[model samples]
Target: MGLLFLTIFLTDFFGYTDALLRFDRVRRKVWMFVGTRSPIELDWDRLTPVSQGITPANSNVNTFRSVLLVDLDAEGDVKFDGKYPRIASIGQTSLNEQQAISQYEYVRQFMELGPTHLPSCETYLEHRTVFRDIVRFFGFLDLARNIDWRRPGETGGGLLVLASILCMLLGWAFLPFDLATYIAYRCNRVPKWPAKIEAYAKDGGEMTTPVGAASGRMRIVLKEVPFILLWVGCAFAVYAWVASWFIK
Candidate 1:
């Protein structure tokens, strides 16, 4: 069970580094790369943005997804090189049509008007650490997003508040998986862009490092240490109690 858990986390951690699409607004081009294949370069004008949606066999609600179809061969038909298409699934998937459009608009606006006048993006986790990796694996960021600290008490008063509390209490159940993810992340490496793509990106100007937010290490120590220690202590106690039955 432990090995299987570690394998799952490792696969997920490394899967994200296998393929990437680099959109260069400055050069008005997009680079499609997968593994060791020669990267496909497409002009921004040739790429068509299409919104797609699907209803799963078991589900009733439609889940919307967006993609940019790039015409590799200006003649209108998609040509495959050996296996994969030249470019595929270029945009973020969303829950609904509005969200899909909003995601696209965010990219479009950034492409057209630079980074100014847009809602600030979440501050990137500049460097990876065990705590940050664990936070990501357990979806702490998602929980934080749902709570909305900026407008406290605005997400309803009674039931919603109770639900959030319950959600947090249940979140600790994934401690084993989160710890496995940290191990996988510690061994994983970030994917490097191809030399050609790197050169192209550096053509106009060097890419700047993203601004990072406070890591909240101090806050975690002060507010969360006791809870974590308590959880670990309880887990060990339960293990010992269970093992004692076998000993008898």
Candidate 2:
């Protein structure tokens, strides 16, 4: 069962990489690169944006998604200059309508008004290193980066702060799962853009610079080490107790 799940997980992860949509804000165009097919190009303005709520049958669970569709025929097939894919779906699904709209708006703003008009966000590029993977796997870096010992009362009082700490630290109980996630991420293939797309990306735009760890964050991470170790030990103890029943 575990091997079956691993296969499914890898398939789902890599299968999505077979195709990709590339947006060129400077050229005001959208490019679709499907499996072994020639690249399809379309004017950004001609595309229709749709935001929808999706729900599976007999389930209350619903998700919101956004897609950019273009040049549809009577049968709802996509065509570009009469030679392209029959249909294509662009953009990712979100948890809510607002989130779905936000995803669309993010692309729209960039394509319509350039990258300068887009919302600002912190960006980082992590090299594929074992140390980086391990820290990220256990969320040690995030916990370290976001921790503010001096301003514990910023969000709420001491009780609320304590509750947040407990909740975040609870993730440590899933050490095995985190390890599996780390391994998958390390082994996952990183997508490389086509030479044409790469050149286009560098044509003319204000690129976002990747930032590194903030000053003194390593010190903060040191403080969190003991807590993570304690939780890991506890998790192992519980695991050993549970396995003893079947082991012998």
Off by over 4 Å in 1: 1-11, 17-19, 62-64, 72-76, 135-172, 209-219, 232-248
lDDT value, candidate 1, whole model: 0.60
For model 2, how does the per-residue alpha-carbon lDDT over 1-248 read when each residue is reduced to its tens digit?
99998788877544443236778877887877654556677777667665556776877876556564565656765565545553346556767677767777777787778766867655533424343344342454455445566884554345434633563455445566667655665655555657887799888755645344232213334655655555556666777777999999
Candidate no. 1 TM-score: 0.68
- For residue 138, what is the lDDT in candidate 2? 49
Instruction: Give the clash count for each candidate.
Output: 0, 1
Each prediction's TM-score versus the true structure: 0.68, 0.72
Candidate 1, 35-154: lDDT as tens digits: 666866767777677677766788887665665554556677776667877555645677767777776677677677776656755454433555644543245434333343368556
Q: Worst 10-residue stretch by lDDT in candidate 2?
A: 210-219
